[model samples]
Target: MAEEVPNSSNTVPIVGPEFARPQPSDLTIIGDTVKDTDGNKVFKVKTPLFGLHNKRILVDSNDSPIVTMKMKVTSKHDRWQVYRGSDLDDKIFTVKRPSTVQLKTRVEVFLKQNQTREVSCDFTIKGRFMKRACRIYVGDSTKIIAQVHEGDDRLVATIYPNVDSAFIVTLIFIFDLINMAGTGI
Candidate 1:
């Protein structure tokens, strides 16, 4: 009987590995920020030129994001970091480039710094190792943002979960409950 039963209309298939959307804001991430038409998961950051002269990038196709970066230091030493931050409404991943940092994506931005010194560039990654760094976070699940900072401390290549609530509800209410009830039929 259970095998012949039907699940509710709410039953949604377990899509793929789910993850929460990336939030704006990660530690002292300064400089400029702008939004595009999609409004989420597609954007860019302009950080003070840091690290090796060339860009070493990373990307996860499983995720839906790809970051291509090129930075150069002008004055002062502000460590570059990308992590999560709060915008009073939700959690956002931030890219902090303090002091003088000029940036440009496919859009524009509102600057927070009062300084006028930065090293910048317009670039695209064409290497395999670099291609591996700018990963993509796709679907409605959790994933880790692989990053490279200027320090002996490097986050191991691992996944940071982005848990989606609606997916969870569908799993519990539609699948779990229906399966349980059907088993007794």
Candidate 2:
């Protein structure tokens, strides 16, 4: 089953009618013992869309909720946004027709480059791994927390640079944090 979030912060709306695939953050974990037909452990990663959802996020159309190794290799910094949507802050939002399963997926842009993402029906606490991040530095994600901009892209990281005053992102997964001074949430 899918959940509809009127809370703006929790949900994202897609453009097409055939948006039937379950989204990222919605990926499920069958079990530590769950295996694919080949007997390899099947750990599913929730996928996110490209373009923007409402005013907070931008989902890359090329980056689908289900990304396989077979897909194109993104060798560059594909742009992502959090304060604007596809319409560029336009209010003409088209909502999906609603379904039995929630298809909204949250895409995490890893700080490190070249980490493979998978598509599955699993929704794990990868987010919980991020709970304390935004607050520490209040960068791009801060814009999200402040209702400024929003996007589904997340860069996986650890508290590396709370170094002296601010967290210095020191890894390949480093995300560009755009902080608009003074909106002080």
Candidate 3:
């Protein structure tokens, strides 16, 4: 079964029958994974790439920088440090994968104000990255914000109306990075 996530920060508007499906006029975009099936990753000069070094940034269409995702390289626990841009200020949130062993993808999200390491998560992502399927949810994992479906050539993300689509795209990009990193989370 597929998962559905609703945007908590934004309210979806009533859609007409004409806009039932995404149209060309819609603000939708496509992203491609830059690696081959054999696990060989390569980056071309002109092709847009996701740079994950000391600072990670996703270069979207027209070679424009969309979001900058920062993460710690030598951390004992898996965590997405920060996300720049969007109305949520420069500090979007932090994603930390639990240390407990599990087969599926489960991570806890903490908002910018959440400095203390509390057991409660502001949001959570649950799904399987190997299948290219995942869902982002609000606190307590009830309300969903976005979802990413796996495709043969690319990952398809259906972002809800009134939500920051680019933010969802960035999350998908980060998922690809962590999944491709061979961390086995």
Top TM-score model = 3
Q: Across residues 18-94, which tens digit of lDDT does each residue of candidate 1 receive?
A: 33323322211111222222333212232226755322121222332233322223413221211121122221111
lDDT of 2 by residue, 50-79 (tens): 532211222222322211111112322222
Cα-based TM-score, every candidate? 0.21, 0.17, 0.64
Full-model lDDT for every candidate: 0.22, 0.21, 0.53
The TM-score, computed over Cα atoms with residue i paired to residue i, of candidate 1 is 0.21
Compared with the true structure, the alpha-carbon lDDT of candidate 3 equals: 0.53
Model 1's lDDT to the true fold?
0.22
**Where in model 1 is the C-alpha error above 4 Å?**
1-54, 61-65, 79-160, 163-185
RMSD (CA, angstroms), candidate 1: 21.4
Model 3 residue runs over 4 Å out of place are: 1-54, 60-64, 85-90, 182-185
Q: Is candidate 1 or candidate 3 better by lDDT?
A: 3
Q: What is the lDDT of residue 90 in candidate 1?
A: 25
Residue 57 of model 3, lDDT score? 55
Candidate 2 stretches with Cα past 4 Å from truth are 1-27, 31-66, 70-139, 142-185
